[model samples]
Target chain A: MSEGPGAKVYVFDAYGTLFDVHSAVARHRETIGPSADRLSELWRTKQLEYSWVRSLAGRYRDFWSLTEDALDFAAAKIGGIAPEARATLLDAYRALDAYPEIREVLGELKAQGASIAILSNGSPAMLDAGVSAAGIGDLLDDVLSVDELEVFKTDPRTYALVTRRFGVTAEDVSFQSSNRWDIAGAKAFGFRCAWINRAGAPDEYAELTPDRTLCDLRGLLDASE
Target chain B: MSEGPGAKVYVFDAYGTLFDVHSAVARHRETIGPSADRLSELWRTKQLEYSWVRSLAGRYRDFWSLTEDALDFAAAKIGGIAPEARATLLDAYRALDAYPEIREVLGELKAQGASIAILSNGSPAMLDAGVSAAGIGDLLDDVLSVDELEVFKTDPRTYALVTRRFGVTAEDVSFQSSNRWDIAGAKAFGFRCAWINRAGAPDEYAELTPDRTLCDLRGLLDASE
Candidate 1:
């Protein structure tokens, strides 16, 4: 059975799902130089790796720290990423260019009376920087961070924080996360999550499949009606 | 103080360290046909992803089951891979043709009379498949699995299990794990670890630098003796 329409709150996962971190790097490819794509891939791989390892070791550091550290590691290996590029690159994350159709999709959803929020794993400062840079603040109701929870998205407490902040029943909230793991966690926690298959990948965990899977927010909101 | 050369057992992680499972698809490129690289990459990526995701979510499935499931998931998206090809692709993993220099290196280590063992995250059944196929059962002193501990490696208990089984103190052993996190966890548990930098990659976690880092087993065993 489909989750009822009362789940009107559209919570978007900020990275990869809404903001194309890849595009952010692509825009600065000239500055990132020959290792641009490699740098981006390495940074992304490192970014995720740090989170899981740190979490496992019970060594907690916020996402921004992890992101910058990962970039620095990638930079040292492939020379020519200037200090200025760091600011521009780091600054670019907050203002990351949305997928070409994102704004329009959000507009359509809001027009139909849905609340959109950014519930990201990004640190507060980092999330603010990206959301402001991309001009997504106007469309989002709240930019929730996992910083306070001292945990990452899959942790039950991480999603519970969002539920408490929004005052919505877990199942009545339309949680969207780009990561299959996040989607799995939300589904397991009773949230009506929409897995944004941006990479066109399937969730491997059969026990925790999302209620709905979509290509993007457009499909998510459109499906509700 | 250096770890004395007295009774220093080298517990080598079997899968990525000595064996390369990537060939599971690469060798069967003919059967994989088109999109061979992509299919192989997805299979490998999903296998690792499933391990980490399943580990974090407190959902435990043996590496064997997860490996097959990941292949099935990837195959489904890659033009519906034939069952026969899937079987052949997996058969390659049975032996995982060791790296070109692995056998000679193992021979050299044996020549030096170093204590050798296979410590892996694979269950007993899975470990037996790979070990017997490669005919390395005679080369290794003891084949250790996380099964006895009922926990995967990178867990402190996993490292302890190996050390405890060998009846040697953690310092009396040099742990070898190609995985950055595995090295980190092994080091955290106070095992002197030699990270095989097979990828020549930078350290994933800056905090967990190995006691000894080397290009491969030859360098590791040679440097110690």
Candidate 2:
């Protein structure tokens, strides 16, 4: 309830929250015609693998590089990745389509005059590409990364960065992520977290239950005030 | 390798590392009935979910309780879990077979005069049951848990505990797991990690590459020297 206009800040999780990322892989199913869903699953799994690996190796790269690396690796599986398709894959990332309600939700949150920022595992470049592609860059105060934390999402330190960056108690911030684990991470770190279970991921962990569950960002925004 | 004789510890990851865990659900495939390994997949997915959720909610139970919760949840999916079957489902855990080489490899590791231990995400009871059931309890010097770490395996602290307890740097310890991400995590935290890729997880993560890959623990011990 303290999250009204005067609330310290409202931290938003990117990836699953503001973006239709599952559609990225699902799109490959439609676009590739042969590999279809296989490509999508490979891309998603490899993408997560890259981010996690890069974080562990102390080799910080923008998420753009990681995604391309993942796509290339996955492409190597069914058949060799065509040089052309790799470029298309990168383009697909920057051109990621926002969920139907994301733009409206961002606009509404902005109109409310609340401080809004993004806490994402995506590298700055990737975040830039996603927001630019979605046309919601102006709505974000800034995009943050676990790169700063030297780890990936679901690390409490990654969540700590949000409140520490804002100089407020975790209660002063409301974190949102479509990934249940990320939501668990934020809640475990004591943030008032909202889980946007767009895919209806079954409950996995305990204690860090989402203070609120929403079908999408618009649902989050609707329920926030 | 700063770990002296007393300092060096071989921390075995439980689920896929030492114990043939899928057999737990694989045994239930008749009741859950194999949609071609659906039960194993569901059990694993739920176990992970329960672990993360319990950690978040601060309702900390040992991994055994969570395992039962996950089994019941997954069992409910294909059909109702009967009380008798629930007992059987859990009994499967206490009597899981070891990976073919686990017995030989663990015996070799211990015979080589290395301090051995289990670092697992399981509740204390589950870890105990798995180790005793696998018939390798005597081979392990100690068992570690997120119960003490207050975080799950992927957290750096989870790895940190073993190093600190054994008084070794992450550089000296050789951590192993069947889970690709857990290996990725140990490597991320700067531990020497081996992927016991029983299910054949590919090296898709370009950054978090394993220092070594082996078909089984025997290969791990063979490669160690």
Candidate 3:
């Protein structure tokens, strides 16, 4: 029941942590058929894989293009998707459904005199559309994208953006990411990290451990206290 | 019927290219139950994922440890693996089976006076054991490990090691890998790349296409022509 470690800035990972990435596929479940979930999972997997591979290769492509490329791969694996349906899926991605508690949590965080922002691999335009559609744009003070540095998450430079933008040391920032790899990168970079483990997935990155593991953003409010 | 692109040196990726990465799990199929193949697939996926993430985060762990970490993840996901069984799997990995055509193809390439080597994300010890077990050490001009650079493949630096070691330009090297991403990296780095598409999985990284796509190493012989 004690108060958690206080951080000067709370930076949340945009996709999966705030907006539900799978919602785009869910919206067109009928069109995708029984393999919809499988398609969505593959799409998400390839998106991250492409990001990491591209980052390591120093081939910087915007996340939007990467998202389309991932969708193409997933669609191919799951069977051909109609061009119209694929377009619909991509459009749906532009305004993905935010998690149920996103608005309430961001409102609470803002009311608590804490600085909040998003640090994401999403391109600026994608993040802008999603944040505005999710109606949390007013709650967040800044939305940082990797497109600025032409790299993706898990890169030290990507994590450095949060510290650089907010003008705070990594120790003064609490980084929250639903992606364990992102958590590992941020934690390794010296941020007080919280892993938003919504799926109860198994642990990874044996050497670097997150500062806290939370099931949802509600747990973040406690950290601010 | 026609000679393919000739290069000064022929470089290959180690795991999945020369050796069978899943052969280790095949050795312990009964212990793993029906999920043996699943476990192996997940293990390979996580192994590569860990490598990419670690490389991006600038946190380098030897491929051997990462291999173990990946196995642990796959085992935990599929269910608890007995400690002794786990150790057995790890031992099996140290000397994975070389692909049936590895010897013949490497011999042919070397016979034609091509300088052939391995440029891999594997640690020195892992590559050493696998090459010795496969009995292809004499056929190789050198075996390069990312351990020296402390970064995994897809990083241009990993590919650069080949050019540096052989004292050849990237254009003077022919890099082959069963991994599409590795091929993409090699191609982007200016190597005459060949994708050993053993699985015939969907193409990715749309812009950076390999110079050739071959089903096996036998096709590599044609390139040496």
Candidate 4:
């Protein structure tokens, strides 16, 4: 086994990081017509918005429920979706396509004696289905969900789950996320953070900076060396 | 003086509820081209998103800074904005137009011997600017902001400011907001919430229902009687 980097555990965020959140809507692009992309964008945006709103309101709803609520809102905004189509989209979400590099990257990290896991806002069942469908289940050491704590990400308690689960301090883990806000939260919580900027999004959260800003997960392997 | 309803205090949310948040972009519509409406929508969406994210992360930046950051994000998305135009937009935000009915509604409520105050996510300075610009400063009994607590709205503590300031319970105050999420939060916190559904948007936060859903601020006067 290759020597691991300073980080004993590499915790990844699931949606957008490993799984393509838009893949579900993309699969239904034919039926959704020209508004498919807009629908997907709105769906994801509202999904995260609801999570943060509920988290701040101290009202905990599972990610799946939030996902449904967001989908409904998106559908309404895009002029209504059929109930059957909505169901199909939600089903597609459970088995979203994993980013092409995810399997190979996770394999490389696992072979290097690194403990890989997912810390996501997805419900436990949702994460399980995603991992199983993506066929990355065996490669991960653990799959942690916010459902365990009854709060969403960016919450310190949500990040603390990693430390508690691995019996490691925040510094011992490298938290990776595709979201700038997630990276900001992880860095603020004292975790070594790697921001996967696949879309080259503009910088935000002026006060916090990630340990590494990578184009994709393949860079995680290079960071180890 | 008109007799009050079950609620003792009329607590208004300054942005959107009283002030026209989109008026800033509407003012710059000619310069912004056809993307003006999109930019305004994005700016407002990101502004609230940043607040919720920051609040969940337990990192509090004042609302003005968040507003600027949000505007920058919106500008970037709409294919870059001129620094001068960006400045103009930000300046416009400080003195956003108050809704047409605000003066009359607040006056009607205040004249009826109801305690009228603002409970908003805006910073004290921002709220002061908005209230002053709207020329309704004399009608308010008090203006409360999350800046004092260093957290944004939807936080129980943020909502608690109303109770503590007025020496009243949640049920004794009628909290009003144009944002459905804000209404959900205020209602969840046990306040008598009036959702100012100006756009007649679809319902959200399925579990919590507001005490009143009004098309405009004029309805507040009717609800009081």
| Predicted candidate 2 versus true structure: per-residue lDDT over A67-124, tens digit per residue | 7777776777767656776677667777676888876777777787767888987877
DockQ, candidate 2, vs. native dimer: 0.20
Predicted structure with the largest DockQ when compared to the true one: 3
Put down candidate 3 lDDT per residue, A1-225, tens digits, no spaces.
Answer: 112355357799999999999999999999889999989998998999999999988898999999999999999998789999989999999999998998888788778767889999999999999998999888998999989899897888998997778777898888888999998999889999899999888999977999899999888876643
User: Which candidate number would show the highest TM-score if scored against the true structure?
Assistant: 4
TM-score of 4: 0.96
Write the residue-wise lDDT of candidate 1 on B109-165 in tens digits: 767777778888787887888878777777788888876654465657777877677
For model 4, report the TM-score of its A chain: 0.96
When sorted by DockQ, best at the front, the candidate numbers are: 3, 4, 1, 2
Q: Compute the lDDT for candidate 2.
A: 0.71
Model 4 lDDT tens row, B112-174: 778999999998899999999999999998999999888887899989998888788888888
Q: For model 1, what is the alpha-carbon lDDT of residue B135?
A: 72
Candidate number with greatest lDDT: 4
Interface DockQ of candidate 3:
0.78
Q: Write the per-residue lDDT of candidate 4 for residues A1-225, one digit (tens) a residue.
A: 232345478899999999999999999999898999999999999999889989988898999999999999999988998789999999999999999999999998888778999999999899999999999988999899989788898899999998888888898888999999899889889999999999988877878889899999999988763
Report how far residue A39 has shifted in candidate 2, in Å. Answer: 3.9
Per-model DockQ against the true two-chain complex: 0.29, 0.20, 0.78, 0.74
Collision count of model 3:
0
Selected candidate, larger lDDT, 1 vs 4 = 4
Q: Which tens-of-lDDT digit does each residue in B102-138 have in candidate 3?
A: 9998898888878889998899988999999999999
Q: Candidate 1 residues A1-225, lDDT tens each?
A: 232456477788888887887776898998877899989987886787666666655566899888888888788778648889988888776677777777888777777677778887799988887777666678777788889877666657777876787777786688877788778777777888788887887556888888888887678656753
